[model samples]
Target: MSDQQPTGSDLSPPGESTSDTSPSRTAQLKRWAALDTTSGALLLTAATIAVVWANSPWRDSYQDLLEIEFGPAALHLHLSLADWIADGMLAIFFFVVGVELKHEFVAGTLRDFKLAGVPIVAALGGMIVPAACYVAVVGIGDPEALGGWAIPTATDIAFALAVLAIFGRGLPVALRTFLLTLAVVDDLLGITVIATFYTDTINLPALLGALVAVAVFAVLVRMARRWWLLLLPVALTAWTLMHASGVHATIAGVLLGFSVPAVAMRGERMPRTEWFDETIRPYSAAVALPVFAFAAAGVTVVGTSGIIQPVSIGIMLGLVVGKVVGVLAFTALMVRFTPLRLPDSIGLRDLLPVGMLTGVGFTVALLIAELSFEVGSDSHAAAAKAAILAGSVVSAAIAAVLLRWDARQLRDPDMNRDGIPDVDRDVIGG
Candidate 1:
């Protein structure tokens, strides 16, 4: 063999570079996972800083910055930069959610009913039971508290994943997969709740405008084929229409997402590249989520009364109690009555920790917190935030410990791996 070995043409035919720049799909996935990890760390860091800053001597400036007002007189609208960021920036977040929902429904996890059933049921139970708990405690007594119904209804994927990672080697990757799938579906429920229960007075003209814009978007999305560029203008236009209409602007994300071409493949051929799915998810989860967390997590609780208020109590209870009962109970029933079975990698003991992690509802909870106090009730908002922060932290901590311990046992290798039957790992993960 020559010392130089085989060069491009010799190694593989023409057009092949020795440099390997074609981008290994595995490498890309690893990189995305790493970024997700980092984003989660950043969110935790930002949240810590927000709590510290809110309680520090510099708290006034922080509060003032959040409340600073600025807007135009054209439509006669004005709100503090904080409100705009919390409400407005969050609409984009919802847009991302819509896209994800569409993606999942079209070709992702929700693609097959057999695979989708467990998560779908778990997510529904998780949401409904929590809402029921909140209602039983507050919503029924005073319907005003009903806005808080969506408070405990979501699971933050970042936080949940991070907790799973902390458990390290022992986690039966199946449990992680199940949790992720459940969170995605739970997010869908949260979005529907926002659209159905959260709107104010509907402006028909504006609503009609939004519908027309959505139709235009559908046309553009279909015509553009795999073109990612087309989505930008259409998304903005949808946002404008949604904002003008009485509908929550965040639903625009769902619309845009649904309009995206998820079924790009037809018959034997791969449809165009899955650029949007591959590219957008990492960008949203890494960059958009952290930025949103930084802007949204800042709240002042320093000089205020330390007692956990009713709103906070409701949120904390709804998440901590509701999620655990809902997920476990539904899963238990499925395992008992139906032919469905737990992933071979998971054990009966592992369910509790995973269930605890399901209570980490940062993103959606924050959005609902904004809605619960959109009328500018400080006590109500603060209480809601406190509850969310507390519940998320407690749930994550408990889950982390439980998962870590479970991981240790899982790595033992002596444990039986019966009934697995070697199905594709992604199916369970989904």
Candidate 2:
């Protein structure tokens, strides 16, 4: 290192900072975005921090910060910071989900009913039973709580996959793929519930306007494939109109996502659907998901009856017990009673961890919890969110244990359940 005099260009005047931060800041953001599609460690950390912050002495600041409002009033885009994150940033997340779902239907595993039926049936069972469990638990004490029956029905694909990736060493690829397909279906169902049941009064004109915007967006993405960035304004318009139409703004994301062509056109290595996912999914995972978790999971641990509350208890039961029973029972019922066949080498034993994984509903469940109650039902919302967090953690822990056991079992060929060596799977760590 050399001792050098400060150059005039390097010197800043008092009270003024030097240099453009945009480039460095933009690059740092890109680095952070790259972490999204990984193990979801960042998302979990955000939730943990939110819980800690909410219970801290400065808890009021957390709430206040979420409630702070901004945006252009001209287009009625003004909304609280939390609403923006939930409504706007989460729209991005849903868009990515839509793209994935389209790919599955068009070219991926869902293209074959025989291969996809088991997980599809399992996804249905997983969703239905949890909602049933929630209703049973919450209905007796509070019939109104039925609105949140769908809360525990969702599976946080990112969180679930992260757990599996970490602990499911030597597991069959089929199991991982099963979870992915199940999650994709679960997301579709979750989006449907939001659109069908959760929506309030409709604004026909605005909804029509949103639909028109989505059509334009669809056309542009295919025709103007080389100018994909130009679709942002149209996408924003759809999101805005959807918000104005009393529908969840995130649905706009789903529509926009669905509008994208799934197959790669001639001369392209991958479809625009994948290209869009590659571009936006990282930011969705790293930024939208964690921020949403932080905002949604900051409920007070002791609020309302908390874990003891009917809604909270119901959600926990639905996520933990309901998911396991639903997946196992419904899957068995379908395979045995119906013509739907389980894929090769996957036994009933294989589904235990799969069911538990579905119970990890950290992200979407919280969104539903928020939508379940009317604004100002703070105590109820708090209880529901607390339940989701607790349920997800418990479910994840259970799944990890089950997965590790299965992996260990696979390590010993003698412990194989079917008395046959499976050639298709990798042992744990393979």
Candidate 3:
């Protein structure tokens, strides 16, 4: 995912550590993956390098790299390097999203209608306002550009959570959970937008095949615990058929995720969902997302004029300003009027940063942009990508500042936000 290139050479001298404390390479990786900001930093670094590569004098190499295609052509599998990452690797990320969604709905606080309704409703508002902003902005100038209205409707869960975890250290866990639920719901809505508004054609026969494979996978997974290796082929079959069916291949991931049972099986001590999360989420975070970001974010600079075009500006406005307004406004109204309530020690002030965090729409926004505009090199595509990058940066920066402020001003050790202080709270960055 590092452009398939090695990164950040180590130059410092080796430091001494206690023999007992020294961990295995796998252990180190697992801990690093758990660091909360590691994935976000990796994503940002890959994206920054991609952007620089796209703009540099050796930009031709960048294009060549992306154009390199592989996979069997007969099975309709021949695809460019970009397609491989966007459609293939990105599915792993969505799979993680699916797991989180399923877990939240089945066993987490989201099961409660009143508690879940806040984020669910806020997510809808977040999507609606941004789409409206995009349509209003571009439709007024270049009506054709309105096709990209869904670009800013997504909130990259990883990126948003990373910002919150790093900068909002003292904030209650409720805030993080709220954002997670909200972002997951937001992405679900975004995927719906993709599946509904963007898909122009369908192959019903292949779609049916995909559903069957998904159902088979669902049953096979729950039937036994050691059936994991066998499940791979079924999952791939589902993905391939869904891809051929003209529906987005990533939907297969969500479907497969929905297939996994939340309850523990016969011999399992924990639920399969948690097991899958522990097993696969690290890869998704470290590899899948960063790779997708690298491929999605490599928008070449054409000129300032195109970069700041009306369509581009509209995307930026929708992502930055529109997401904040939508999330904050809907959440405020919900908390004020309805029986739905936020966790204790959290207030509207807490939601201000959360609102800003929701605006950090990077990976999913970029995906929608590609789907919105024509594939390959196009001025409109370039402008939309540039705008998404810009908007995401602005949103993350503002959210970080606000989260830091909130942490300092409203520091509370109530990690779970249940009005009771958690004595076992983890030390920040430990």
Every candidate's lDDT:
0.67, 0.81, 0.79
Where does candidate 2 have its weakest 10-residue lDDT segment? 1-10
Per-residue alpha-carbon lDDT of candidate 2 for residues 117-138, written as tens digits (9 for 90 to 100)? 8899899999999999999988
Q: Over all chains combined, what TM-score does candidate 2 have?
A: 0.88
Task: Give candidate 3's root-mean-square deviation (CA, Å).
Answer: 6.4
Clashing pairs in 1: 95-253, 98-254, 99-257, 170-407
Q: Model 1: runs farther than 4 Å from truth? A: 1-34, 70-79, 139-144, 224-230, 265-273, 410-430
Candidate 2 regions with alpha-carbon error over 4 angstroms: 1-39, 302-307, 411-423, 426-429
Q: Which ten residues in a row have the lowest lDDT in candidate 3?
A: 1-10
Better of 1 and 3 by TM-score: 3
Q: Per-residue alpha-carbon lDDT of model 1 for 1-430, expressed as tens digits?
A: 0001122123221222346745465545535433445557867887787778877899767677777888764642376766566556666555555665666666666777666677678888888888778777775445666668789888887778776765534455566667767888888888888778878788888778777777777776666345546667767777766777877777776776666566653331222123334444455655567666765677677667733655677778889999988988887787677776665455556778878888998988888778767523555777778788889999988887876676556232322233545343332112
lDDT at 236 for candidate 2?
88
| lDDT digits (tens) for residues 136-202 of candidate 3 | 8898888977788888889988888788878877666667767878888898888788889888899
